[model samples]
Target chain A: MPHRITSARKLMQGNEACVHGALYAGCRFFGGYPITPSTEIAEGMARLLPKCGGHFIQMEDEIASMASIIGASLTGTKSMTATSGPGFSLMQENIGYAYITEVPVVVVNVQRGGPSTGLPTKIAQADTMQARYGTHGDYQAITVAPASVRECFEQTVKAFNFAERFRTPVTMLTDEVLGHMREMITIPESGELEVVDREKPDVPHEWYHHFEITPTLVSPMASMGDGYRYHVTGLVHDQDGFPTANPNEIKAKMDKLRNKIVRFADEVTQLDVEMVDDAGIVVFAYGTTARAARQAVHMAREKRIRAGLIRPITIWPFPDDQLRELLAHVRRVLVVELNQGQLIHEIERVAPKTCKVAGLTRYDGEVLNPVEIFKRILEVK
Target chain B: MMADPIQSSNVTYDYLRVKKRFPNVWCAGCGIGTVMGSIIRAIDKMGYSKDEVALVSGIGCSSRLPVYCDFNTLHTTHGRAIAFATGVKLAKPSLKVIVVTGDGDGLAIGGNHFIHACRRNIDITTVLINNQIYGMTGGQCSPTTPHDSFAATAPYGNMEKGFDPTTLAKAAGASYVARGTVYHVQQLDKLIYGGLNKKGFAMVEAFSNCHTYYGRLNKEGDAVAMLKLMKEHAMPVKAAKVLPPEKLEGKFLTGVLWDVEMPEYCELYQNLIDSFQEKDKE
Candidate 1:
C-alpha cells in the first residue's frame, strides 16, 4: 500500500504561521495591543501584511483593539485581534457584542499566566473555561486549540473559515510555548488553500434580512454603505438587527445562535485519537498540553498501561457525545491540562460515573511536562 | 451697504439632523458644542454628502455626538470608537469616517488606539475634543488634564504631566495635525476643513472648556468669564514671535501644526488588490 503525500510546505513559527494563515484566508485588517508571548503575532502581521496590502493597527488598549477588529469586520473585511490574559479579559464586552451582532471576526488568545497579568511571558491554559464563558451572556463560541506550531497555521486558517462560515467570532486559543516556539511550516502557495467567505444573501440588498436565518441559520452580512438599510445592535435583536424585548424573540435568536453550531457538531468539532480502539485507559488533553499528553501516553504504553490519548482540536461543543462513546468501554479516563482541573470537569460530565476519572492539573506558569503526566497516569491506574 | 459675505455654495447646513436640537449634553459654557459646531460647519463648507459620512464614537459624553448626527452613526463601547470607525472606513473607503472623542475617551482610555490609528494612517478625520478633565465622569482627572489641575481624583492637584495632543499626533505619524480652541471658532472650522481635505489620518484637537467640572474645580470662573479670559489670553503662533513668553503666558497657540501627504492604508490595500488582479490577468 502506498501512503498519500501532502503538499503542505513548511518554514514558519506558530505566530508567523498565524499571520500567513490570516492573509491566506483573506483577513485584511488586524487590530491588536502588544502583550508578551502574543506580541509576535502582531509584530509579524505588521511586517508581512504591508506586502500583501492588509492593514495592521496596534491599538491604545486591548479593549479598543478588540472593538476595532469587530468594526473592521462589519465593513466586510476579515479582521482579528491577538492578546494575552488581561487583554483577553478586557475584550469580553466587545466579544459579547460580536456574539450578539453575529459579526464574523477572529480573536487569537495566546494564553499566558493570569488572573491579572500573573506572568507576562510564562505559559498557562487557565483561560480554557474563560474562552467559553468570559463574555457576559448565554452564547456559544467556536474555540480551536493547536498542539503544534504547524497546527497553529492550519488551525488559524480553520478558525477564520469557521468565523466566516458561522458568521460569529472564533477564538484561536494558543498558549505561550506554541506562540513563541519557532517551527518549520511548509508554506503552501496562495492557490493551494481552501479559504471560506461568509455566505451572502442571494436576494437583492433591500430584500436582504441581516439576521434572518435560512435553513442553515446563518445569514449573509451586508456592509454599511452598500445601500442595505439594516440596524446592528448589542441587544438581543430580531432578524433585522433591531432590539426586541420579547422573551420569545430573544430566546429564538439566542437559541439559533447557540444551537446552529451544536446541531452541526460533527462539522465543527475535530479531535485526534491515538491508540483508543483497543486501550483500556484514555488520556484526554488539548492545546500545547496535548503534546505532553501524547508523549505521556507513549510512556504509559511502554509500561504496559494500554493507555490511549484523545486531543480535541475544537474545545467547544465539548466533544461530549464523541467522548461519551469513547469512554463507555474504557476502564479509566485521565484528563491532563496546565490549568488546575478545569477541562477535567467537562470530561467527567460526559464520561459515565462507573468509569473512574481523574485530572493531572498544574498552574505554576509552566508547561505540564510529559514526565509529570506519566507519573500521574501511573498513579491513577 | 456691504454685500453679505459670500457664503460658499458648498457651505450648506441642510442635512445635520441633530443640529437643530440645542442644549446639548456638553456642560454650560463647555467648548465641546462650539467644536462640534465648527466640525458641522467645516463639513458643510467641504460639500461632503452627509449620507457618505459615518460618525463613530466610544463611551463618553462626547461619544454621544454620533447619536445626534443623521448620517450612519455608531455609539460604541468606551474608548473603542476609533477601532469601530476604522472598521467602518475600511469597509467603505468612500465613506467619510469622522471620530468625535474627548480627552478621556480618545487619550486616557482610548490612547492606545489613538497612536495606532495614526501609525496606520488610515484615511479618516478624527476630532479629539480635549476638554482636559473627564467631564462626563463628574470631573475625574484625565490623561490630558494639565499638570497641577484640580479634579475629584486629583484633590491635591494632578502631579502627572498632560499630553500635548498635537505633538503626540505628529509624533505618532498622523498625516495632518492641527490645534484649535472653542473660542477660536472660525480658526477651528478652517482647521477641521483642512483636516477633512487631507488624504490620510488627520486629527484636530479642540481645546474645549468644561465649565462645569474642570472650571468650577480650577477656579477658572464662570462660563462667560472663562470665554472672556480665553479671548484675552490666547495668542496666535505668529503673534507669539514679537510677544515675549510672559506676554503670551498660559495661552495656547492655535493653527495647523503639521500637514503632509503619505500613502494611506486603504489605498495601499486597493493597490494590492489591483496588482493581484493584474497578475492573475497576466
Candidate 2:
C-alpha cells in the first residue's frame, strides 16, 4: 500500500492554527485580554472555543488574563492565555509564580516589535531571550517556536503537552508574521492526534505531597479539594511544597526543577535538519526567520555551496549539544533571527571555538528576507 | 434548672473549618473575622460540602481567609487570586469557587482582572474585602480607598476617588452584584449565599475594616471603635429610600443590589461542543 500524500492544502494563519491547536489539545478555558497580533488568537478562541464546550474570557488586562488561565488549569482543565509584548511583560511576575509553583500553563506570546510598545503591529523575535529568562528567577521554561501556520498548529499542541507533562509553563514563542499570516493546513481528524495529560499522583490524597518529585523528576499533581493539605508557595521549598529556609532543601528542589528539563533535553528539544549530512556551512534559524533561511540554504546550494539549515522547533533548552556536533564538521555557522542577535549568542557559545560564527540580525519590524540572509552568509564566509 | 437557649450545634458553628483555634489572625473587633464568620455560616446554610469548595486568595490581610478554611485553599500571588480561582473553577466546575481578596488586591493591582472576570461571567463568587487600604502592605493607597482618606502612601490625604466594587461589577456585566458590610452580619450572610447561588459571575463586596492600617493613619479610632463606626454608618438599602442623601451620605449600603442570570461562560462553551457534535453527526 502506498502512503497518501497531500499537496499544499489550504492553510490557516499561524494564530488561527494556534486556536485550532488549543481546541484539539482539549483546552476548555481561555482567559485573555485582546491585544494586536495576539488578538486573533483571543478572537478565534472566543468564537470557536465556546462551540467546543470551552470557555473564553476577555479579561480586564494581560495580568488578570494570565492569572485566570493559570487558575483554570488547576481545576484539571487545559488552559491558555495569549498576549503581546507589553502584556507579556506584565505577566512575568505571575509567570515566575507559575514556574516556582509548577503550574502547567500554555502562554502564547505573539511577538511584536518592542522595547516598550515599539510597534504593536510589526514583527520581531526580540523576545527569544525574554521567553527563556523573562520571569524573575532561576526556574526553567520550555519555549517552542513555529515557523509556519502548520507548525503553529502542530507546535501549540506540543506546547500544551510539554506544559502538562512537565507541570510547568510552556511558551509558544510566535511573532506577528506567523501569528497573522494565513496559510492552508490539513488538520488531522480526532483520535489521530496524541494528547498528554499531567501525571496525577498515585499516592492517596492523605500521603500526597504537591511538590514531591518522582523518579522522573516530574512531580505528581493533586488538584485542590482532594484532601491534599500540602502547601504551594513562590518561595524556595522542600518536597512538601512548604517554604524551607534550608539551603540543602532549596538546592535539591531547585536542581530537580531545573535539571529535570535539562536532563530530559533529548525528549523536549526538537529541530529540523536539511541538507546537513555533508554541509560545510550551517545556517541556524527559528520562527518566521527560519522560513527565509530555508530558502537561503537552497539558494546557497544552487550556487554549488555546501549549505544546510538547522531549524529549531524547541527554542529553549536549546539544541546546544546538537549544534556543537553540527559545528564539528561545518566550517561556518550563520544564525539568522528577527532580533538583535539574541539566539546568536547561544550559537556563539555552542559552536566549536574554531568555527566562524556570525549573526544575521533584524529588528526593523520586517521579516528577514532570503536575500538578506544570503548576503549575510556570504559576508560571514 | 435553666434551659440552654443555644444548642451545641448553634454554639459550635460546624461550618467553621478551623474552630479548635478560635482566635484567628484578625485583630480584636476587626470586621474581617466577622466577614469570615458570615461566609462560613452562609456556606453551612447553603449545604455545600467542604470537599466541594475551593477557597483561593491573593496577598493581603483579608486574603488570608482561605488559610483559615480547611477546604481546598490556595494563598497565591498578590492581586491574582481571581486568576487562580478562575483556573480552579474551570478545572472543576462541580466545585464551588470562592475568591477572598482585599480591596487593594482585587481592585488596584488586580483591577483589570476583576472587571474582566465579571465580563466573562465565569461562575465564581468573589468576596471583595474593601478595608480601604493595603493593610497587608502597611496602609498604602488602594483603588477602593476613599477620596480624602489618609494612609501611609497618602500622607496628607488620598485625593483620588475610590471604586465602588458593586457598581464596577454591575457595569462590567457581572450576573450578580451585592454590597454588604461586616456590621450587617445576617444581611451579609444572605448576600453571600445569594452570590454563591447565582449562575454567573457573582461579586459580594464586603465593607471590611482595616483599623490597624487605614484606621490609625486616618484617625478612625481603635479596631473595636472602628467596627462600631462602621455599624453606625451602615444603612440598609431599603431604609435608605426615606433618609435624606446628606444623612445617608457616605453610609455603606447593605443588601443584594443585583441578581440576574445569563449563560455562564462554561455552559455556553458546552453548548458549542454540543453544536459541534451535532454537526459531526450530520
Can you give the TM-score per candidate against the true fold? 0.79, 0.89
For model 2, how does the per-residue alpha-carbon lDDT over B134-196 read when each residue is reduced to its tens digit? 876678999888899898888989989998898899999999999888877888889999988
Task: Give the chain B TM-score achieved by candidate 1.
Answer: 0.91
lDDT of 1 by residue, A137-244 (tens): 787979999988878888888999899999889999998899888877776666666889987666885587789977888888776665564555565778866557
Q: Tell me model 2's lDDT, rounded to 2 decimals.
A: 0.83
| Clashing pairs in model 1, backbone N/Cα/C closer than 3 A | A9-A186, A9-A187, A10-A185, A10-A186, A10-A187, A11-A185, A59-B112, A60-B112, A60-B113, A72-B87
| Model 2 C-alpha lDDT per residue in residues A274-331, reported as the tens digit of each score | 9988988899999888899999989888888889999999988888888888789888
After superposing candidate 2 on the true structure, give the runs of residues whose Cα lies further than 4 Å from its correct spot.
Answer: A1-10, A180-184, A189-193, A224-252, B1-29, B119-122, B244-250, B258-282
